[model samples]
Target: MRQHGLEAAISRRRFLALAGALGGAAALGGCGGDGGASSSKVTYWVPPNAELSRMQAYLADVKTGFQKAHSGTTLDNVVVPWEDALTKYTAAFSGGNPPDVTYQIIPWMNKWRSTGVLADFRTLDKGFTDTFLNGVNPDYVKAAEGPKGELLGLPYVGGYWVLALNEALWEKAGKPTLPKTYDDLIPFAQAMTFDKNGRKLGESGYDARNVETYGMCWAPSPPIQENYLWHYFWSFGSDYISADGMDVGFKDDAGRAALRHMKAMVDSGAVTPPNLYSDDVRWQAAVMSGKAAMAWSEGFTAEYAKQYPQLRIKVLEPPAGPGGQYIVGACGFLSVAAKARNRSGALDLVKYLVDDKPLQDFNKLILAKPVRQQPSNYYDGLDDPRMTTFMNEAAALSKYVKITRILPYQPQEYLVGKINDFLLGRQSMDAMIDEASKQIKQMAKAAK
Candidate 1:
């Protein structure tokens, strides 16, 4: 809804103009000197993490191993917060000082490529390109492509949403058989929801306002909402945009049904109120504190379990909708800056990071699936069977996975915010759908 920061406040046109001006200035300044392809130093940027110590150790290992392998090269590792990464990257590029390589999301890759700030790895080392193309998942490759099919980035990790249940709460609710369909999930959720007085939904004298625990908890903000809602849209035979990318795809009966189902869950008082817990951390805290019985785990249950071993969390396939069972999947990518000083060194670092051993360790630490087809079996050794279950389910559901397209103008935050407004009863379902459709068409047409 409301624009968040400097990044969101700047209009696209104004931002581009500023970037072009600064870029030109940097170009006239000799592009910060030619470090050349075989330069001995490379700078890298990664997103911020809650487990600072663990992530620092991982980065240290990467730096040590890379320096050892390259023999005389230095690696400058930097941790950038996701909220500030886009802005920082833009400033860095404009100043001719961007990191040689950075971890980015598909949307960022698309955004930077449009601004000529991202490099096409296809134009880099052939050996690395060949290895990446032949080894990584085709779905991810597709997700990371530029408008003209250029390799904007290399996929590093992938994940999908799953149903995460609190085992203790499940047992308290009589351990009812897990829901297999959206229709079946309602009653199960009702069973898990209760008031301070111990009255569950549908029972006489139950007070929804005084509820102590909810059946489900999930953040309804921006990116998280978009990611979580896509699973429902796909399962209901709807999608965010049409295959041709010319229009909104979910404007029909399937879309309406999906929205209605979501609204019903909220109206049933079984889902955490979006207005109350608008933050992701608070939503996760609800599940962690045992105040919520279930949640839509966005591929983080393993990390959560590792952090909180006392809570028994179980991962289950998302409840199927009438159309089919599906999962909304996405990938994180590694991209080189277009003005990177050491292109060859950047490619080398990307290669080293995605190699089997390092990739396995990274994915294990984050509990993510590798971009490569031959995934590591480190999950098999986890003390929690749920981690193994998540991995196996992700692999099994690969066929049913739907990856969101990287659009020139990503309106995901606005679109999902409108959906939340509708969910919170601020607007009618028809108004929400119609307005969203109009917004998508207008943005898409403008981008074209």
Candidate 2:
């Protein structure tokens, strides 16, 4: 397996450092004014990296309505890159002039608390945390909790992963049915995999050298990469770590069996060889051009599929790996900086953003829906059926949020990339498993 390039890791750390270094910038920018006046102007930092455009629109609509209702205060929103959010956030704390509100993933709450960068919401509004979607998922909440068990971030959105199927390929393979259980999936994948000569199903004259369409196109990367492994690990009734993420769980037999099963997908040619960074364009080209059969993608992808009208696509829950278990992942939340200037305004923004009106607008504009209490009023005439489909699947499965651990910063990504390398013939499966287990243990030890 290839080691994560030094530059890749350094770039990430440097980004965080820069964010922390912003204390002087805020001071120089004159942003350290004493909490704005009796009526304050609050600054909120939204990650400016990729979602800048999407967040900009959401903030605009939210600010217009919020300012109209709350005459006492105003909102000043800034888009910070996810890469720079940590550093910039800490920098805000350095000058004691932090933005009134900020966005963050829940798991980092504990990490930030250790740095004394986060403020306790419990100290400000006792009922504020409870007003939001606290139980969206326990794992998610745990990710957002401080080491002291205080809530650090609020649940802003909910989504899950799904199998993206190219129906054209399915129909070509004699209308093969979508497998629901692990037992049904292997054979189905084998059937979907074929040679260019159209020789399939172990029939006569099968040509090994002329493999045509792949049964699956799976990547070993972040966001969606390790998803396959998690299903396998859990279906076999195993976990990556213990409840608190304090111990490694993959050292056991169930984990080994799960790893073996996943590796078989590559050995048997059921899925593509490991390509850590499988670009979206490559996936679209392969799936649309009929070179690949299926892809594992999130809910937002279905909406993007509309651009290719000629391709007949479908979405289904990923096949159960060992048991009839399915896991779903989602993203959404609005956080108030602990050192925020306009505490009242921050809380109000959280209320309105997660509330019905703006949440609905966000769902429309971004093409990604949220799990708010009230459904959006904007979808009455939206011609997109993908939204309803994604919502139905999300509603059916219980969302499982990622666990946030301090030491192995990007644990899931590391696990997936390493194991995937073995599956692609880059290393022995046993070696990969052992190495990953060791790394995870060291990470846990460091966290302690």
Candidate 3:
């Protein structure tokens, strides 16, 4: 809930990716339109990542933008601070004051759908969806469907995982670069790492026990572990759970590869040892201090720009593994409450918000990738070579990316629990997989 700025959300949200949750927005139904993103009177609520003073400006822009495009409409916008989002959204829903439209993260989306309070956008404007999500895959939209099979809304936000490299250290190490495939990550990290005595890991005098500058950085803290490792699990081909949600399906080569890769990073002295920084905050600090040459995580785009204004942060999609170049994340939406006061307007607005142009302002403010699935440069209007790479690589790699989701179990605890044991050396990847499989089975049985 970055109401004013980054310091709050950055420090408080352990994962930053999923820390702030959104839910509870809808309007009592009555109004009409051609199931488009238009309405004469539109009331909308969005997460307050925008600056407070600029709320009116944002609203004005939306009002102007919508009216200019549609030819006779007014937008009334509201910014709900992330911290107070849940409270306010809840009041809106339970107190019968849900807005005409509102956006939320995936978890709450399940909640909204189960309540049967959200409009089925698919049914509302079938033609618009085709136009809005022209190039996007149908699976992403299907995944966002409500618990009861209702197409709640189109998923509108996503936070992609990208690698942040230290240019100076990379050039110093003869510019060890991104791998053609993820399989080469360890070797690259090895080449980029340095022992405390200024010896590269493979050098004759290199000492693993006395490592100084590492090529990679990560923390085993639960949330951070889940955030950083989940994608690897996907890349390495671990489903984390069975399709039916009744099993943890990590008992295979893919699962082993995922854990082994993380271990190799640490063992090769390319990543900061768990002994040094036990949390991402500290691990990120290590990166800033030149203790690590690179880190792969979220908030890097915005945080680097803010915290290390002068440092040019190089970003690339994490290399493709055997399972390919998919990223792990959730996609939520800006749904029209079933009973929205201006259903047509809500539909139209949702359509607009998910497009490239309408998302420009929101995208400018947040570092995460936008939800629009079409090919759009990640940093199109921004100036910077690193951002240029960010755009090019993201555009080139998006097809390889997948946003995974499930409702039957809590992925954070379910997967992170086993990963923690594996990270701590208390269990083998196989052992962890076995344990997770058992736990998921039990949980599924209980859920039944």
Candidate 4:
């Protein structure tokens, strides 16, 4: 698994050094007056989007709106690549400054708090956190509470992972009934996996190498996918960490089974060998081109199937892992920096961005559906029946979705990263399990 930008493995020392350099360069660019503690200037950093030009235009528009609303304050917008955000942002701090407002994914969000860079963005508004308590999945609300009970940040935009399949292709293959439990998923996946000869694993002409399609590849894609696989670890009735978030849980029977199942997908020829950022694209392409029958994807899949309208896509509630049916979702947060010289401005912007009008508009700009209490922005894709189908299914499963509750760490480090090592033959599974357990216990101890 060659590093593809953020997911590529870099030693901790090297990663920190790189981030420090990036942060130093940005700080030298002037976080806008007095080293990012400016009284009248507020620095806002957002993760990079698919189209950077579109983001620039949107930020320009937002600048105008925010200035109009604030009268005298200035909002300086910064773009941080989403994938390596933690390191870069950490580097910014090392550079002697960080943005006043930053957008962060869930896993790293708490890591910030642990690092002392996180501000209680909710403290600015008395009822602000209340909005998130039940706005989306209630789990998000529950997850927002920090280990010490403080609200982490507002649950911004989010999506949940689910089981998706090409209905037409499935019917063509005899409409194999999907699994009801994790124990049953492997065979179903083996049936879906096929080679150049169009033979499933058990077929006479089946070939593992030179494959035409894969059964499951989600777990192999890292940095981008470790969190998704972490969801699987929980579903398999074992967590990556201990009850107090201080130790490894994978050495146990349940975790061992889940870890092995993930490895079996590769060993059994259910997925392609590790490739550099190829699995995600190839798996989707395979499904669309009738080479593969199923995939695990997020709710955003609404737009994916639309690209191949001739094909019919259907979704199933994720099969219950050893732990029972569970789903993992994530959110982008609008958080204020604790040491901001312009607290009032940062607070105002955070509140403004999450307001009904701003949130709805933000969602539209990103092609995401609005989850606000009231709708003011018209999301065109919301009208697509296919998107609606996906949304409805996601909404119905809200009861099972877990957001920020999972352990906040380099999910790649002790979890999927080590697992990848096992798959790559760089390490033995037993060694991976032992080392991951030891590292997790140390990390949890340090979190305290």
Candidate 5:
């Protein structure tokens, strides 16, 4: 959490005093329409990403609509970077002050709750919690719940790693078919690999890589594979943790097979060598510039493509693996600091932000699939065939992705990068896994 210099001005005592004096706040079961974000003025902190910028643009309409329907409320927004979110959030709480409501990645919900930074959302109105999607993957829900099964966050987005195609490039490469299974991808990639000079697919093209373009790129660099690789790991029916989270899963045959497959991709030169800092921006540049042909990317790619008018892109299910189809992530939500300046107002803000309408609107702008399947007015213009295809795939195929509890100890991106290096022969799998397992056991012991 990164804090702004201004946060220091609001002391904890002053903040609690402010909340206590806000007399209109209601008890737990009652809705506080005029007190929450519905208050005359309320603040919201969101990630300062392109996704949020797009939302920021439409916030006026959203504020106006809500204010019009109610009376005097206004929605005030703050933008925070993903890397600095934790520090900022902590600073806010230390002073008994924080935004009325704010979003955090799912994994951190439990972490925050343990520190008593989050409110017990179960105390909210009965049907409020009931409105989320049914049959949501249990593992995904478990990730958001704190100790003793307290639900700390509500998933508004169901993020999954997916295959994206540059149709023009694919057709130029001879309209190769989509891969149905992990093994099938090897040949599909072979067909897609081409060079203006007609050299070996990945390496033979040119020192400058005169190949028409790369077939694909897997990010999270050399010594640590990215979390995205988990989808493939799971496709082999392997997990990073045992069911009880008591032991590492890497020594299992299935886990080794998955690692071997990823290693093979690196060895075969089918993917980009890892770049420690090549985040989504680097990924966008590679695909948008036609330097790379395909990617297993986040759903936001479609949303990003809207900025490039000439680029025609399409989304598809990630190729199935030995275990059938697989996906590796779910959505995340917000948690208010328990010691906020306007505690009641903060809870109200949470309810307001997650109200069906805002979530639907946010999902629409980001081209996200809903965690809840119930339809909303937000989907009105999304009936186009292309949109339908992607949406349907998201609904039926994506699965919740989870990993060993050592997540906090092992920077997720670093872990994936390390694994990639091991597979590339830069390091041995046993040696790498041994190091990772050491970290995992330490975390597991601490968790105990």
Candidate 6:
């Protein structure tokens, strides 16, 4: 899932509302159609994609392939808008009419699991579990597991957030070397930043207010803040919360250092102001339109190139820090509902969807990497060299990346909002840290 897309659809308010409904939903029973092993039908629910027509065509192909593979079986495909998905799923479960299988992100796992509607794939089919485990990445498998290590979901697609540079801008700046460390990035960005009069940053008569091109851009708003910003924290050796999930983890030296470095970038006047371009589209536009020379992006260079053919974009390795090189990744999963009427048929459909052909096709459609092992057609099918480079870099960096966890509370809004306030000079660094820490602790306590 794209960082902005996921964040926009599931706001803090909506998540809290879903959390409230999950409590009562736990006591509700299933009410959908009953289809035993001999049943001829299985219902599936998927979130809508930005490429609606293409996704519809892909789904149609999937239906044909699935029905052909399983004679006498029918696939009931349904598209659910992400904005209303949580409520719809909750209602479906409460009314006992939930789909047999549905698409889910890592964050929603705990909430739906709490509602007692997700099936434990481990118990449903050991053969399928063993096959899936042997074929898919272990990290994705781990992300799909429940607290007790049960297979609550089957991960299929994944992506990472990395640094993307405007090659033309770098070429114009005398082809300065790419930054390998966090400390190196500021100067690298400043070299590319210029004023309306062509005065480079740090040069005489340069004006920050009249910046014609920014050195870098990053999203610090809700929905994508946690997704994109936390890499800096991880690189600085800080986490938002303790591993046990009981206390604040960012109220430390590393966390403070990370915040200071972020502020320094803003203070350098080489970064696009957070208020000016707060969302993903605007963030990409900053780079595409030559307003910014580089950006923290989720491997969207290929798509950006299509829109602006003249601009040369290059995917770069994530910057390293005292903590080491690190990036954040997220995966999408296909999960079966516990109350599925055709439990056996549902399992079959899940396994079928993960098979090589369908899985690779789905990943290609979304421009995501398949969760399965590589050396397959998926990699060979990538037409863009930049996309291939991105895939290769992502695979090499997978060892340093961590899949986002299933947290008890949504922590993006509180943490990112305070950081933005500090960057914008509305609050002191100390105040931002203290206030954010307090809110996080309260959220954890309340979740219990």
TM-score list, all predictions = 0.80, 0.80, 0.83, 0.73, 0.75, 0.86
lDDT of 1 by residue, 184-276 (tens): 888888889988898877889999889888888756656445556776777888876777776777788898888888888878778877776
lDDT of 4 by residue, 91-188 (tens): 77656567777776555665665565666645666675565555566655555556666665666665455576767756755777788876677777
Q: Top model by lDDT, which number? A: 6
**Residue range 1-448, candidate 3, lDDT tens digits:** 1111221212335323332432332222332223334346887876655334444466677778887887776777776656666676666766555777887665566557678667887788888866766665454567668766677867665455456677777887998657766678788777888877889987898998888788887665654454456667788878666668788656667777777877776666677767786555676555556777777555444445556655655565677778876655545467787767678777778877765666766655454455554455555665444555554455444454465555554655557767767776888777787778888888888866
Backbone clashes (count) for model 3: 8
* TM-score winner: 6
Give residue 421's error in model 1 in angstroms: 3.6
lDDT of each: 0.70, 0.58, 0.63, 0.61, 0.56, 0.71
Of models 2 and 4, which has the larger TM-score? 2
lDDT of 4: 0.61
Error of 4 at 79 (Å): 2.9
Question: Each candidate's root-mean-square deviation in Å?
Answer: 6.7, 5.7, 5.1, 6.1, 8.7, 5.4
What TM-score does structure 6 among the candidates reach? Answer: 0.86
lDDT of 5 by residue, 1-448 (tens): 1011111111112223333443333122112122232335556676532334365575666566655755555566665554455676666655455666667665455457566666656755446665553555665566667776777666545555457677777787778778777777776666566666745474433433455566776655321124356666678887766656655676788888988887776655556655523554565456556666677644434534465556756666667777656555545566654544445555566666567777666666655555544433335556354454445555444453432242333334445655756866777989888887776677667866
**Residue 58 lDDT in candidate 2:** 69
TM-score attained by model 4: 0.73
Cα shift from native, residue 61, model 3 (Å)? 1.3
Choose 1 or 2, whichever is better by lDDT. Answer: 1
Which runs in model 3 stand beyond 4 Å of their true positions? 1-40, 54-56, 67-73, 137-139, 147-149, 285-289, 299-303, 372-378, 383-396
